[model samples]
Target: MKSSFTFVCCMILFSALIKSQTSLYMPLDIKKAYANGTRNYDGTPGKNYWQNSADYKISAQIFPKEKLLKGSETITYFNNSPDTLNYLVFRLYQNIYQFGAPREFGINKKDLHDGIKIHRIKLNEAEF
Candidate 1:
């Protein structure tokens, strides 16, 4: 009876460990938009306009590598919405981290604004 009880307890713990190992993933598509058969004056394919309608996905992962911290980021873009999207805006929140400092942030706010032109600005303080 004692051995049977121990076997059942071990089984329950093993099952819980397996259940906790599930993974999650998201799908995204990226595309470049340009006029068909368009050629540039310099004899190269015309540049694509990122401003046209588009979709995007951003992902990050953290893993330990040989006693060091390592991570990678991937950004996927797609064009599907009607409005032409010329640029992308990404707001990274490092302030939430305990080690984050204002000076440690590297993104250039000026360049971010230059990349995308906003047609309208709306604020909903209630949402905040």
Candidate 2:
């Protein structure tokens, strides 16, 4: 009788532990990475894994009274992927200050100004 009660208690505890555990939900990209051997199940980079990187050298000057900022950045990008690269994309956040740029809230007239003007872009010594 006492042994039977202990066994029942153990069984209930084991069942509760099983129900408490949950499986991790992996997204499609993560599953693909695993299948491609670029990521291991132990959360480590696999032998096939490689990452690209960039190095940037930037200098900037700001005028507080005029609310003006001027900057220049030279970025060197390393392509570690197997695919060939054709172009690179850039995002200019300051463009939001342009006269007619879309905005979620109203902006003061004085706060609006001509968006960032790119004087020139030079890639590998070739101006664009």
Candidate 3:
């Protein structure tokens, strides 16, 4: 099942890439780095550049009868950047639905039931 989903997603992405041929906009510093030979001019890569990605295991279930959707994920992040880590940032968008979270507009009162609950957060198997 996962293989089929991955195949469909890959096909869609390939089609979009072929059709759009999107180009990334590099900043002035990145262009300068390329000019100085620290990075490749044609987007090959950079010498001091770094990137990071993590494999995630996510499972979600939907209940049409209850009108609810629940999901959980385990993400093991790989910090391959050539920089020291201070802290990780997490955004809770559901806080926009909080009763009085300094919103630009208003939200439904009934929707203020425990916005974005994080049962546990662990780094290196040690809770922070």
- Give a tens-digit lDDT track for model 1, residues 14-118: 999988857544222211212333444344655432233333343535443432333433334565444776756756444333232345446555222212222
Q: What's the lDDT for all of these models?
A: 0.45, 0.92, 0.79
Better of 2 and 3 by lDDT: 2
User: Tens digits of per-residue lDDT for model 2 on 15-91?
Assistant: 99999859878899999999999999999998899999999999999999888889998899999998888999988
* RMSD (Å) per prediction: 22.0, 4.5, 20.1
* Model 3 segments more than 4 A misplaced: 1-31, 35-38, 64-68, 108-113
Give residue 117's error in model 2 in angstroms.
1.0
Instruction: Tally clashing residue pairs in candidate 3.
Output: 0
lDDT digits (tens) for residues 1-128 of candidate 3: 99999999999999998998478777999878887666786777767666788899999999867656688889988998768889888899877875567788767776764466677888888985
Q: Any idea how many clashes model 1 has?
A: 9
- Candidate No. with top lDDT: 2
Clash counts for all predictions:
9, 0, 0
State candidate 3's TM-score: 0.62
**For candidate 3, which ten residues in a row score worst on lDDT?**
108-117
